[model samples]
Target: MSSPKSGGAGWLVLLALLVLVLAVASVLVGASDVSMLALLGIGGAPADPMASQLLFASRVPRTVALILSGMAMAVAGMIMQMLARNRFVEPSTAGTVESASLGVLAVALFAPELPLFGKMVVSAGFALAGSLLFLAILRRIPQRSSLIVPLVGLVLGGVISAVTTFFAHRHDMLQSLHAWSTGDFSAVLRGRYELLWIGFGLTLLAWHTAHRFTVAGMGRDFSANLGLRHGRMVALGLLIVATVTAVVVVTSGMVPFLGLIVPNLVSLMLGDNVRRAVPWVGLLGAAFVLACDIAGRLLLHPYEVPIGTVVGIVGSALFLFLLLRTRARVG
Candidate 1:
């Protein structure tokens, strides 16, 4: 049998190839008929001008958004896992995405004229704050059981989401909040997606702190022994998670299970080494979202299902299965 390390390396390679294939497939699977033949300059005549424009204008942005958001959420999950020391921790689980959505709702209600960038900043700030709050609560709780930590975060997130829903309802902005909660890439366009560059920057920040995080995850005493500031590294990780959550929420909405799903899969196949794990997490995340987006577009042709719906169905099922499996193991 192959060793786990070799298996992980092989899986990472497979996931990378899958990501590339799915990304190209996504770019080709929209409403307009743009054959792979035409795309390849093979034997087909050029598609209609409007179709071509639609392909470039809408499909490209949507696909790019998928890849970026996927990478961001997956990395955010990895960061959360390292900081919280729990396998189940995710941006959504920790309330970052919901908090950002709440901020977006507030902006829409009070500052209707605010530019998208302005709105994104507000949401990003709140998302980061929410993540920090979860971290703080995490620290306060006794570390007797790592499992309980994520449960606390989930409860806290639920409370915040309830508060957000209450305010949105009172302000008659529930619909707006609802729209943003369900991950949808249909609205992405070129100018609209420039904000995602922030996610790229945050990813770089995560990369820079990767080593510090691995040390921090070893425990406060251990990290301090190594002369690392555990609190600062945790704070930095939360910031990256929050910023990435905000970008994804504003760009493609919630995208359930990405944070929980990608990192776990990567870690399972690759083992717990953060540095080695990150690339596979990102590629698989990107590929998973891209594949889901394509399936959403084609499954209900002429009436595209939202990417969010597809992911929700698949992710929720997978999440529950993972949860049960974990519970069984723990039991």
Candidate 2:
């Protein structure tokens, strides 16, 4: 049998190859027919200027958004799970995404002239506040069953979502907010998706602080015993999670369980050592979302399904499986 380290390295390589394949396939599979041979110069340039334009402008940006958004949300989920000590907790469940959506709606209604960057900043700020609020609530709750934490988060998130919806309706921006909240890459283009690079940067920051997060995951007393500043680490982790969540939500909208499912799946296969698992989580997250997006594009041929819808269907099933598996272990 392969050693754990070797096995992880093997999976990393395999996942990297898979991501590359999917990325290329994503570029090729679109409304316009841009063949691999043409892209490779084997058959010269694309048949039409429109094909080249579409390839460079639409497909490439959309693919990059998928990769960045997937990896960021997955890493953000891992950070949240570590901090909450609950496998089911993630940005979507914990009110972060809903808060960001509210921020966007507020900006659209109150400050209609705000630029895209300004809107993103406002959304990220709200996300940070919402995440901090969730953490405070978690701190107040007495240690109980593991399931309680996520339940509370879900309730909190639902409340936030309702508030957002109410305001959106009042402002006559319900359809706009709904479109922004539903994850889809069909509208992605060169200028629109540049914000997601912030998520990429934050993901790298998360990796750098992986060991700190692992220490922080062991609860306050354990982190303190080792001379770690427990509060500071948790703050930093939440900042990373909030920033990534906001950026992804602002750019690509919500991709449901990209975070919740990816990190748990990575932990189930690889050990839960944050440092060891984070890179794999990122790679697998990107690949999984890319696969889902491709499936969404092809599922209805001319009419594409939203990536969020595809992920929601698959993620809900995986979440149920994880819940049952955890219950069995506890029993």
Candidate 3:
């Protein structure tokens, strides 16, 4: 009999290969005429100058951003679920994304020419505060049911979003705010998406500390009994989540239902073992975004539908299915 570990490794290899294929497809499917043959210079056909231009300047960067942001959000979400001890909680739902968006809006207003790194710092600070606020609210609640927890997060997110919108409208930055809040990859260019690399690095840190996060997920008392610094671990997890949230929002805007649904779906497949599931989460997340992006490109023909809308439609439906299924399991 094969060990589950070995079996999982096999599946992991397969998933990685699948994600590679999806990445190639992402590079090929675009408004421009970039094709596999052109990329390969196959059949002695010279690469079209336009194809090369589109491939390097646009498609490659966009695809890289998608993978990095996808992995970051999914891994960050998993860390969050572990810390919250709730499957449904993620950065967006917990008000972290809104806070980061607010931070971006602040930068746009106060420091219009702030470097990307500077924006990341400010946004991360706000996202960390939002995450802490959510955790504080969770502590005060007497009932911490799975459904109830996410509902509270949703409420908190709504409040933050409302404030952000109000300030944005007042300052005439609503259009820019919308661009920052909606996950659209159309504008991603080579230099623009480097911020997501920082997010991806933080994601690697989360993977390195996965076991600690697993312990942190079991509540303070349990983690304390195991000789873990529960509070510190929680802080680290929140920092990782916040930084990644800021990075993605700053680079490509908020991709809703991504952090919430990807981790939940991965949990169903791999159980709650953060260490083991981290790679799978990243791979699945990239594939999820790639597929959605491809569909968005095709759905509207040359026009493109925005990855956020496509993922929102699909992820929300899956979320509802998971909710009902979990409810059934509980019943």
lDDT of 3: 0.88
Tell me the TM-score of model 2: 0.95
Instruction: For each candidate, give its TM-score against the true structure.
Output: 0.91, 0.95, 0.95
Error of 2 at 309 (Å): 0.5
- How would you encode candidate 2's per-residue C-alpha lDDT over 1-331 as one tens digit per residue? 3554544576678789999999999998866777755555565554566667888899999999999998999999999999988999999888898988888888888898998889888888899899999989988998657778778988999999999999888878889988878998999999999999988998999999899998999989999999999999999988888888878877878888778999998787776778888889899899999999999989988678999999999998998898888889999
Q: Following a full C-alpha superposition, what root-mean-square deviation does model 1 have from the true structure?
A: 2.4
Clashing pairs in 2: none
| Candidate with maximal lDDT | 3
Q: 1-331 in candidate 1: lDDT tens per residue? A: 3554654566667777888788778878876766655454456665356656677788788778888888888888988888878888888788787789888888888898998888888898999888888878877887546467667877988898999999988988877888898888888987788777788778767877788899998899999899999888877887788778877887778887788888887777768878877777778789988988888888988678888889889887877777888888879
Residues 1-331 of candidate 3 have per-residue lDDT tens digits of: 4343443687888888988999999988876788867766788988677788888999999999999999999999888888888888888778899999989888888998999999999999999999999999999999677888888988999999999999999998889988998899999998999989888889889889999899888888999999999999989999999999999998888898898898777777777677888888888999999999999999988999989889889988987888788889999
Candidate 3 to native Cα RMSD, angstroms: 1.9
lDDT of each: 0.81, 0.87, 0.88
